[model samples]
Target: MQKLQFPAWLKAAYGRCPDAIPRGLQSETIAVEDACTRVTSEPVRACNAVPPWSVAARNGYAFRTEDTNPVPGSRPSKLNSDSDLLAPGRRIDDPRIEPLEPGTAIGMNAYGPLPVNADAVVPDDIATALDAIQYKRVLVRRLLPRGANVIQKASEYAAGDVLLQKGQRITPERQAVLIAAGVRELKVSKRPRIGVVVSSYERCAPLGSRSCWQTPDACGPYIRTLIEQWGFEVAQIEYISPPSRAGSTPQALHEAEISYRRRMIELAQRYDLIIGSGMLSTESHRRVGLNGLSWFAASSSNDEINISQGPGSRFNLAVSRDRSPPRTEKFEVKDATGRVRESHSIHHFDRATFVNLPGFLSSVTVLMHVLVRRIIDLYEFVETPGPCWEIGELARDVECDRKTNLMQWAKIVWGPRGEPLIDPLPDQEPHRVSAFLDADVIAAIPVCRGGLAAGSRIHFLRLDPMRQPAAPNCAIPQPIEIITEAHHSTEFESMQPQMNIAQSWSCLNAWLQSMPDAIPGGFRAAASDDDIHVLEAAISAKLPADFTASLKTHNGQVDQDGVCFEGESLLNIKGILSEWTCWRDVIANDEFEGITSDPDGGVKDDWYNLKWIPITRNGMGDSLCLDLDPAPGGTFGQVIRVWHDDERRERVAASFEAWLCRMVMDITGLEEQKEQKEQE
Candidate 1:
């Protein structure tokens, strides 16, 4: 039951293949504008320098810097203006235009080539216009430096400069630069052709079929679409039908196997890569009367290899066609000196690679994202993996056998401390499609591990772009009253006194009554003194007096929708104790060891602190806590925000009382605005 490591298998399979161009991958000449996302077959060079000639950067009078000189407390220098103005599209050699003289200036428009021998320009704003009997005169108030307001020719890029390297994909920004550098055409690699074969023992209907007993062929279309998105072309998708259900006769099985083999051979010759889906497992191959490894071994003299095993690694089966006689073709290419010379390229026909993928939608998705994408990148000569990788804590334990790699899909959720928590989807069975639909990342569990425990840190590849964390909606309202430095001092003597607990609670209660929907199902009853005492003993930290008073007035929220502060709900005594104990366990186990924390505005520099008691939670691991053990310059009992996925620990208020007052103000202000709109 030993399984091969995927990386080692990939290296051994295609490692020796020359880094030279992929065999049979041809190049085509296309307009530069249409080459975005296409891989380049050869390097691209600029045909001409940007800004072919020295041009004026501003609309002003262009003249040699030596033409004018002004002394302190003396009158400005005057120069004669040329009869003809210089503008874009006007040649300097035109009969009407004259070469710039030593004491003369020419009117030049922005982006217009400078008149011959003109080295500087004084902007119109600074040049005073004077009427003269003949043409005109411009008075310069000061001496200007040479080359001022002029864009020198060839400054951006010189002709024959390499714009893009071979094997690089043309991104939109790169394309724009290439086009600007006078590159009109590009030689790009042709999209690799892919053929998909879905071989299933059960009769599956095509999409949109209404057959009551037959399931649809989901893997074929899904894989095809994914391949297309990777810049490859799916030439054909064929389905191998199962034998009659009435009986499994030897003759019927033989005919089915012959048809499947013929289709595979044809695809291998016509396509660069042939993907075989379904009947990937040994048991499934036996049931279908076709063994992939045996068939490939018998069909070709080349070595047949099992690249990897297990559900996720099954697609690593790579089979190649028989080697063919090498054929050479002559083509023309430019050398380093820009000389076009004839070149010869050798290629072997009918040498396509084959990958046997499992039939389940979940496995298909993982393989397509991780394995198939990498294969395409190889063919295209892409040097880097596309998606970003990140670290996250497991939300729950994931159990798997020690003999196989477990590829699990997980949804990323923010923990109460702004850390990323990986929530593995429940439906990982091969046939289930819901897991694929809800997954944000794919976590690859290496072989020889029985399981991963909750809170265990693991690295995962992002399936899609990470979503931005929810913004704190109930932030301190505008016309913000600036809290003085004394308010945040560690000593309470210097702190600004806040409104009494009763007054703050009254304001919050009135606002809640006005907006009944604000707290869905209303608030829970106040916590008993015994319950509060239990919470304090569990966390080994005493609650702030203001927080205790507020809880006694009305404990935590009754429902998730009752978000009271900064997109979080007030936690009851028991809820606070549970959250505190859980975080404490994670810290005690050193699960967050070596993890970095981003502290802002006097917050302590630590991932999690035992003295920070959870007061409110948003259920995704983000919480607002009362910091009893603040940093050196921070005030005690200050409220701070903790995010699960984010490293930031932001101080929200000087104290719990201050936070409560701000929330009341925000709610009351919102209500007043709503009333004003109604009045209007």
Candidate 2:
């Protein structure tokens, strides 16, 4: 073998290897219970029908639909309640079994199979006793629907249908389904074997280092543990030191590298994967000329292992030839077999001393994980043979009457029957949406050092749902509508003695007032001081006039001093109108509108002819934009342009307004508020 200096780069090693190293293994069949975590080796098929036989669908008695013959004074004989309806019954033409009146004694039976030609079998409770007849009298109250009592055979599935396929993991429900289909065994692909190579100097402690721990050995255990968790067996992890310098020749290191490579190749044949642990570079033999083999191969090749596809692709190359010493000049030597696998012209430098090995290795681990996960996904696609169980989300139209609790919100995905056939599990639905927005008395911290303890927070919950942003067609930004401004309170925001009663009253009153039409017919609002007892008394009285007068006269603003005005005040009117200017600017730029109405009645018309200045935080403190429909809906804000000079303020206002509009549209968007107009 030729003596060579190992190039000290980790990328060279990675480039020479494949990303998803192929595994050649056979498939095998296993029972469903024994196949957990195993990849499917082949697609499975159903062996039998799902519901194999006709059986009782309910606890009620089964009888022929024609049993309800309208013959009076003729009492058809009855059978024992415990007897199967399918068993031999008095024939429809039997002389002894006379037809009974509409309201006569009928035998009671549960789980009985219906007899042929019998129209119906009414339960005992439905039939009035004619002479208190015993099990001998047959009676019925109503006609039964055809095929109502029978659970037809093979209703779910048929035999010889695919149950599962190769490269798929079996889930619990899938197992049950397979069982129902009469599948006893399943074939699965062999688990991929992985060899983890941790090439690092820390693996084996050098002669001078006091730390006896080998880096490769220490890291190997952790790597193996993680790999096993991913459902793969970890092969052996060994540590190697820098080649010896005793012989002043590259022969020793060459032999070691060849030995290690050959062992790895052998292991690869048996296992799906293998990983080596040790520093691929050579900082160990600083006093000697012997370097690592990884560096040697890198030095002998001109091509770099580092490729464009992240760190993992660095493992897919041959060798690099370009260097100062020109590795080509020294590569004419032969291996122990008298043949060279690498190019003859490349010089083989010591493979030790590769910098950036640690970071590169870490990145390699991440890349490998990604590749493995991708392989799992591909396998799943190929293995799942049926209509690939999928989750479909659709908006279940709910009438306002059904909107009672959180469960109804869930029923949007689930059916109205309350059983969640496809109900989105809690916390899995679109973001965290909750009905109760906690209320608390919020107060500002006193600037004085003599700290006044802030008021205790009193949380108030409202019966509302959390709102989310909506699609473009509704003309409202958010799909969900929050009828009230019930904000989240944090300790940081409230530092003073928060008035719980006042905050609670404010929120409740605001919510009530906002939903003017939602208030009950006889309900009224009244208020006095911000006292719980006083508020409760007013609620009992249901006096709206008293509440309205008391809040303005006694409770003061009942709002955050700096909070944006939610009322129909002068500030709000001015703010909304001013915001319109900004909206117009956005519309002009985005080209969503052709003209914007200005406060001066000037239609800034022909947006197509104007150039819009792009607004960004860097260029200015804040900017406005407009979102107007090409058509009109008679809603003022819907067609209005809005603006806020402050970014935070703009975001908050826009978000809230979007929600407000959606709520309004969900309610009044359907029709004009006639009663509202009359009151106004």
Candidate 3:
């Protein structure tokens, strides 16, 4: 029987399909600073020439090249050595502002602005070359060129020159050019999101059934790592170990097909590309059949390894938009010699492109390098499309016992001479998970040929998923606000010693004022400063900054549905005083065992001490309190929800400000904030 192959099948498919690859990628604006390794969607041109002026290239004295002629042997020019020629405050007036004629030496470096009249620059070492007499006179040893030691305007790039070209990655160097060009924004190819699935027909047999679904050691691990390193996102990639009778009964196969088809279409909806690996039914882990390809049971996916049409091809390129997948695809299976063995039809999506890799060693070997790599290249616009093979001599004897015509791949590794030495691994065999480990290079052994020697030269690409550029991570700067006069005045007024707490209730009132539809009327005004002062004196503890800040602005509750365990309202100043007394009466009899769980982990000490201030009622016979054990110079303000059992005290925030911010977010924002700042 003749050998079966993927490349040939792919070629046939390509001949039947359109030559043009379908549209897949889209363009988006990415901050120039956040664009390292990102491909340019369009050319990034400079708005203005770099430097904008001819400037000195080094630290030296600028002067007329004409006067420096025959320097060591000629009379010293009368160029004034007056360093005072520069303006005060480390600034140099543009030469246009103050002209300097020949013989006038201006001291400057690359960092300093160019003077309008100065031409060449003599290095500081010019002093060493000259005698003591010439040194004192600030003279040079030779005549310099017209633009010597000077960086001419636009020398790097002029206005409208491309700083970053389309299809190019913004590497560190390219990023620097954009920065120098003052291009803070640009367009980059959007990173494609991918999804991977490993479906097992046996999966129908209840989950965790004898671990038949054991994950492959080398399966999608390297693929995912490489894709992520290329800056593409992989939604998920998993391995499902072999087994099952999905092929036994037509009914079982039907069920499997239906189940897997639904799964594929669902994932296709969410990911740009889908690479699904099937189960390892055969011992060699290669022969793919209906059970293996059942994941896309309705699609045109045949259990054949055919990614060589690669990513730049029609199907792969469809990732940018929709692939317009056929709702169902028909497949006819042929024996090795070309006789039809079976015919089947499977469900496929109209938009998702799915690749099926059968459970075969040789198949994995061939597709892993060629196809997967092309996908990454197309996704990232990685300029280099591959077949970058390297030549190397075999260090050891190669075993060639096969008599079949099937072309296969064997894993190889490098030897001492920098040449990739073949460390031959088994091929086309069932489940050679061992080969999946400890190998890098691959060598193709032809039919009817056998080296069986130690010095035969073999070719392979030195491609290793580990060697690609790691994903680029650029940090974003948070916005910082500058304090305005209004802000300063507000702070000053709010902090006045004579001001009563009730007088500064604008903050809470203002917040309430803006939110009328808010859980109506549970909140009220704060107590007077004198009243709060009396409470503080009784507790002998200072309130946290955030707690006080909120009280000044929002000292009341409005939650009718209740924000806690029961329908308890947020406490106003008067409510707080009342809640404080009721809590005091209970704690007087039983020991305070309130141990609040810190959001950052561990227990907060003495959480329910009399020092804690009340914020709201729990209605479950407990109240929310603000712990205010001021740090020597700091104010205490951690929010804690407490219960009477002296148990289950949950610390909500580190400060009142944080607590208020969280509450505001809860009321207006969608999620609760739980920030754990990492220790430096």
Lowest lDDT sum, 10 consecutive residues, model 1, at: 468-477
**lDDT by residue for model 1 (1-680), tens:** 11112323345444422221236556899999888778788889988787666788998888887777633223456889875555434444422244687789887788877776788888765565566355488766445668989988777888898888787677777888898888999898776677887777543547544456667778888888877765567766777664444576888877866776676666667777667675545553533422343455324333333344334545434445554665667667888998987676656443666666664677677767766665665566543423334555787888866666666788888765555678877867876767778788887655556678877766566664222112211211234354544323333234454456778777666655644544446678888999888888877877889888888887877874355554567887778878888898899899999887877656787899999998888778989999998977787898888887899888877888877766665544433344458999
In candidate 3 the C-alpha lDDT for residue 102 amounts to: 60
lDDT value for candidate 1?
0.67
Give lDDT tens digits, candidate 2, residues 1-680.
11212112323443233322222334677787766556666678888776653345554444544444434223332323323222346424322233333333224244333333333444433232332333433333233455654565466777776766555566556778887788888877655445554544445422335355543244356456655765566655544343343554587767866665554334434543434333332234322211222333334542233432322333222221222342334345568999866654433331111111122233334333423333333323333211111122223322221211111122222333322222212231212223111211111111223322211111111111011111111112223443343233333222322223334344334443533322222122332344424433422322223223333333322221111112111112123234334545665577544443322121122332112111111122232222222222111211122223311211111221342333232232111233336778
Which candidate number would show the highest lDDT if scored against the true structure?
Answer: 1
Ranking by TM-score: 1, 3, 2
User: What would the per-residue lDDT of candidate 3 be over residues 1-680, giving only the tens digit for each residue?
Assistant: 11212233344443322211233445799888898868887889997678766788888777776655443223334455545556664444333314465666776766465666677776554322222344434644334557778887788889899876677666677788888887889988876566755554432222334455544334455556656775667765644333344346887766754664565556666775666554443444443322344344334433343332212121121222244644655679999999999998755333444554444434444555656655544555544433244455556777554443232344555554444356565543544545445556545443336645876654544455434333321212233454432111112212323223333233334443543423345364554677667767766776655456556555566553344212346776667777777767767877555544222222244545676677777566677677664223223665566676655655555555555544443332112111112322
Q: TM per model?
A: 0.53, 0.38, 0.49
Instruction: Between candidates 1 and 2, name the one with more favorable lDDT.
Output: 1
